[model samples]
Target chain A: MDLLEVKDLKTYFYTYEGTVKALEGVSFSVGNRKTMGLVGETGCGKSVTALSITRLIPDPPGKIIAGSVLFKKKDLLKVSDEEIRAIRGKDISMIFQEPKSALNPVYTIGDQIAENVLLHDEDLKNLSKKEKKREAWAKSIEALRVVGIAEPERIARSYPHELSGGMCQRSMIALAMVCNPSLLIADEPTTALDVTIQAQILELMKDLIKKFDSSVLLITHNLGVVAETCDDVAVMYAGKIIEKGNVREVFKEPLHPYTKGLMEAIPSVEKRKEALKSIPGSVPNLINPPSGCRFHPRCPYVKEICKEKEPELFDGRVACWLYGGAR
Target chain B: MKLRDYIARRLLLLIPTIIGVTLVTFLLTNLMPGNPVRLLLGERAASPETIAALEAQYGLDRPLYIRYFVYLRNLFMGDLGMAIHTPFPVSTEIMARLPATIELGVTALVLATIVGIAVGIISAVRSNRLSDHVSRVFALTGVSMPVFWLGLMLLLLFYYRLGWLPGMGRLSVSIGLEHITGLHTIDAILTGNLTAFVDAVKHLILPAFCLSWLEMAMIMRITRSSMLEVIRQDYIRTARSKGLRERVVIYRHALRNAMIPTITIVGLSVGALLGGAVLTETVFAWPGIGSFMVESISFKDIPVVLGITVVLAFANIFSNLIVDILYGVLDPRVRYG
Candidate 1:
């Protein structure tokens, strides 16, 4: 069975101007030990999609409009908020962007990891103060070890602000996976680290994921990261997924023009460029999106019908006019 | 060695700051049109011989800089000079009243922190809910109400209307407890006089509440705003995504980070509280250093006023030092020399 199956997920932000459809009817699925790479340009709703899975969307201005996020046997959208919370860190966990900001500065990285493990167990929560401390310490050390922190005992006692950005990110990944979560949602986890550190972290994550045998939802703007780490790819634009396929197939023969453009946009290592191949225009505004295919404005091949009626996710989940309802 | 060095550096700076504050209060107190001799010896204290004797005795006949030196020298020598209106030394009177003010300030501070932090966390987590709106309204209303007015209103409501509490003084003065600490509540508790202790607490309740109300509001608002901002941070999101409960997200991760701003506000409020105490003390008729400071100012009692100013400045400086030291504790990245 698939670890996660999201169907028509629609997250909206209710602003004064109008409701911004941040994630409009997005759908995907990942199997056990599979890594699904979600790629898009900035402001293309990739992060919003990740946030929607955890139901971490800030309210008042933001709301989940419609969708069904099914994990295992349960429909996550229909689950109680309390239940969703229980599932979030243990059933599925997330690694955030900007590792420096992703770990609470006031708390030690170990405490944060321990919090994830202790969250679901009432016994752990209800333990005597001393016992709670003992348990938290043990769990924290274990998590620190998992993240390749050699001095787990020392690091567990130290605050996140004392750690380097790379260490912090590793701690974050450890925190997410410590509960032995079945799935991990890593939202640009390596974006803030330098290129070398990024490669090392990704390698570590790959080794850990293989060792733990867990699924991953990898969201990034880096095509190279997707090519390196992910098994599958979903290219999104204007709050909608434009293309979905096996990572190698998609990278080798990108179906959507936007996907093709994204690949070309990646700066080749051979020569640093003065002007990289830029996607012609910015992401379309979600509040007042184009009538048809949302990416039509930026698409090199825009047809008349692409402007009026929105294209449906075709067979094999291709989202383009040229796909013509076919995979 | 580091902590010692830190404290030493702060103390070194504190010396000049205290002097500057003392000087300003001294100059202002001296400049104000008031006759200490007249206030001390009635209207007939203006004979030339009597005035000269008074001036010589009080060391007021000296030039401004000389008097200033005498002030500093006396302070260093453990003498805070004499009170013109009373037989007791300025230090003695302040010491007598210091316990009461400390009791009041500590109670009020505790009250402010508890109420402020709770309300702030609630308002931020449940932003835009009824509780959030109510907290916001309470914060604004609390800020606008003058301390004296609030004290009076509380006095009237709790004392006159309800007749549940004492109208003035630390207690009814009937129930006497051991005055080991000079603070009635502390002394009462120490002597195992629960009734007197309760009475003393009852007496403090209304005034402390009145005093703490603005501070509570400020704390709540700051905490709320800071928590709100921190909750939006990536760490909080990461916490939530960790499958941690909302309670953990709000309290453990968001609350502490939020305290960065709130601690700053707390330090400033401590200073402001000391400043605001004079008015509060007057309104409540509490015999604190604030009341003494006010009386000294009116009588143009330079020594007492200067003494109060130094104490207050020291209180502010020390409280801030504690807060700065706390920053290193709360956030490990803070490495102060």
Candidate 2:
């Protein structure tokens, strides 16, 4: 059975403009210990998909219209708030994008990390004050050690505001992975980082995956990062995943027209002076997206059928509409 | 600037600011339409020679600027000069009255802080519950009712109508004045005179309530709103998700941050409380600085009035400086600069 399966995930944001269909009929799955990279353009429901899984959708403006995120053999949508909270940072921890803003400024990094351990560890119940403090100390240090922070003892005393951005990000990851969660959702974790720092963080995450023996759902708009770290890839355009397959297969075949366009757009060091390929038009408005395929407007292989009826993801899908139809 | 530097700068700025305050207060008190001599003369006695000699004696016969110079000289030398008709130094009169005002102010502040913070935290914690609604209504009534009117109503209801408490004064004038520290309550405690203590506390209840009600309401509203805003931050969610319980989230995490703005308001309002206590002092006949200012105004004793204004301004400036210093302590991100 798949470790995490999202079936027809639909998260809509109610705005004064209109109910933005952020994630419409989105489906994907991540296997145990398999890193799945979710690639998409900005505002294409990528973050919303991750937020929906955790049920962190902000109220009033955002709502999960429909979805079933099956994690550990249970639909997350059906779980009560208390249960979901238990699952969070314990069963499935998430690493947010901006480290600086994500961590509370007032708290020491030690306290923030100890929160996960304190919340999940049953032994902590009715713990003596001394015992609890000792446990907290051990957990905080252990988390810091795994995240590559030397002198964990001294660093634990430091506050979030005192730490550097990279240090803060590492601390956040340390907190998330402290529980050794089965699945890690890294939503654009490296986007806020510099390119060199991004590579370092990517390597660190990859190392953490091996160390923790957990699967990762790497959400990013960067195809290059996907190539480096992801094993399986999902290409999302507008509000739907246009194509998906093993990373090597998807990169080699360049199946979807949109996928092919994204690949062609990357500047290769090998190519001496090839002019970068630019997609013709902007992404369609999500409030009133085009009737059929969201990418068809910009698809080089756009056909009459592509504009009329949306093509579902076919087996080992390719750009050709001939395959998108009934086998 | 470091927090220290910012505070020092503010304190330094206060010197000139207070001097300016002294000037304005001095001028304004003198500028009032009524004449102190006429008020003192009781509407019956009048002689031009008497008026001229009294004017010369008090130096009111001199130019306004000359009078200001002498006033400043006497003020700097710590002589608040003398009351227009009396030989008693204005400083002595103020010193005598100071304890009464301080007693009333301290009691009122303590009452305000305790009742306001209690109502605020309760309202915030139980938002929309019976306690919250009752407190909200209490705050609304407190804010809307004028302090003088509140005092009168309270005096009538509690003293006249209910006969539950004394209506006025710090202590019964029938009890001979006892000296040490001047606060009747403290002196009673020192002397182990439990009866005096009870009498003093009885005398304090109505006037203190009159002084504190509006301030209490203001604090409650501020604290409630700040707490609400703090409770919504992402850290609050993080704290709750840690399963630390609602008390930890509300009291520990949210209340700490919420207190930053509340502290600022509290400081400024302390100064405002002193200013607004005039009517409370008057209605209760408390003989505090507020009542003293009213009397001085009625007598048109500009020097005494101006002297009190300057002291009040210093208190305000000093409180604000303390508040600015507290802001840094509460939020480290708020640097001196």
Candidate 3:
């Protein structure tokens, strides 16, 4: 069974100019111990999907207007705030893109990691304060060690500023995984690192998730990273999931024209081409997106029906009129 | 550098700063048209001999450089010179009144800090809401209104019209307490004189609030904006996603990061506080160094004025030093060198 399944997730931001429909009918699922890559261009609601699942969108400006996030057979969107908060960090944890900025500057890395353990580990509740600290500290160091951080004890005592970007990201991973969460949502976790550091972080995350038996929802704009690390892939276009399938299958045979465009845009070392094919138009303004298919304006195979009626995910895999639809 | 070396370096800088302040005050006071010797002998100007003797005694007969050198020498020897009108050492006079001013200033700062931070957090958390609007207006009124006007208005209402409080002075007339720290409240508490403690607090309420109003507004505005900035940071998001309570996310994670700006404003406001305290003390008729300094300035009592200026300058420098230390504490990136 899937560990997390989000259906019809609609998140909007009420701003001064107008309502920004950031996420429109975003749906996907992460199965047990499976790493699903949510890939899209910038501002395509990849991060919003992660936040909506955890209910972490800043209110007033943004709200999940419609959604059902079923995790372990329970709808997370319908859960009480207290229930959602309890599930966050304990059952499901998240790591963000900017490793340095994502960690609080004032706190030691070890203190931050230990704090997560102390907050979520129920068995530590009955222990004495000293014992709890000792246990949490030990667990925090162990998490760091497991994430391939050398000298976990020393790194734990250091503040975020003292650490390199790679070290900080390792510590962030340690912080998120200290409680051994079942589901880990990593939102562009390696986007802020150097190219070499990026590979290391991706490799470390892959190895650690396997060791912990945790399912990952990896959100990134880097299709290369997705191809290397993800088991499944979901392609989003202007806040809607246009195509999804096993990574190999989607890479081998991209069904939607938008997915085909994205694949073509990448610089391939294996198949050298004269020039990379680019998409025709920019992403539509989400405030007042195209009425039908979000990608129809940029789709090479755009038809009258594609412009008039929004396409549904046919066969639970692709969304396009070119596929089997009301013809 | 080590913290001890940093503190030592800051203390060494204070010496040059104090000398510069004293030199400017000395030059300006001596260059003025009024004669210190003549001012001393008000009606006795009929006798030139008495004037010369007084001038000689006061060392005004010496050249400007020599007199300044003498003043500096005496200053190092803990002698701030004698006040012409009061016939008392300026140091003694200041020492007598310093505690009252310290008590008032410290009380006002503490009150302003606590209320300002609380109000700012509430306003930021409820941004664009009614409470935020109300606080913004309240903060504007506090900042724009003059200190003396606020003091008078508060006194007129609570003292004259409603008579709910003892509106002036350091203590009520009927309350007699031992003077240990010279701060009536502390002394009363130290002596276990509950009646005196209560009366002293009642007397302090109006002036302290009046003195704090402007600073409170400034601190509130800064804290609100700083908190607004901090709550948007990625770290705060991480804190929230850690399954910690909302209150913990705000107070522990956000507030600490937000305080650097607030501390900066607080440190910078010491000058405003000292200046405002003079107006507050005068309006309330509170017996503090402020009223004493006002009298000294009017009488052109150069020594007393110089003494107060030196004290105020030192206070400002000391507060800035404290702000630097606080910055290091709040953000680990700040390293002393």
The candidate that wins on TM-score is 3
Per-residue C-alpha lDDT of model 3 across residues A1-327, encoded as one tens digit per residue: 699999999999999989999999998999999999999999999998999899999998999999899999999988888998899999999999999999999999999999999999998999999999999999999999998988999999899988999999999999999888999999999999999999999999988889999999999999999999999999998999999999999999999999998988998777675676688889889999998888988888889999899999999999999996876
> How would you order the candidates by DockQ, starting with the best?
3, 1, 2
Indicate whether candidate 1 or candidate 2 has the larger TM-score.
Answer: 1
By summed lDDT, the worst window of 10 consecutive residues in model 2 chain B runs over B237-246
C-alpha root-mean-square deviation, candidate 3: 2.0
CAPRI-style grade of the A/B interface in model 2:
incorrect
Winner by DockQ between candidate 2 and candidate 1: 1
Ten residues in sequence with the least summed lDDT for candidate 2 chain A: A318-327
lDDT of 2 by residue, A86-127 (tens): 887788888878887677665678878887787787778899
Candidate 3 chain A has its poorest 10 consecutive residues by lDDT at: A268-277
Separate DockQ for every predicted complex: 0.71, 0.22, 0.82
> Fraction of true inter-chain Cα contacts (below 8 Å) kept per model?
0.91, 0.09, 0.85
Please identify model 1 stretches exceeding 4 Å from their true place.
A119-154, A269-275, A325-327, B1-50, B63-66, B155-166, B173-178, B191-199
Q: What is the lDDT of residue B214 in candidate 1?
A: 95
Task: Please provide, for model 1 over A1-327, each residue's C-alpha lDDT reduced to its tens digit, 9 standing for 90 to 100.
Answer: 688998999999999889888888898898889999999888889999888887888877888888888899688878888888788888788888898888777777777777766665455867887898788779878877878888988888777767888888888887877777789899998988999999989998998899889999999999989999999999888898889989989988988888888878888777675577888878778899988888888888888888888887777657787888421
The C-alpha stretches of model 2 lying farther than 4 A from their native spots are: A122-127, A150-154, A269-277, A280-289, A296-300, A304-308, A316-322, B1-81, B85-251, B279-287, B335-337
Report the TM-score measured on chain A for model 3: 0.97
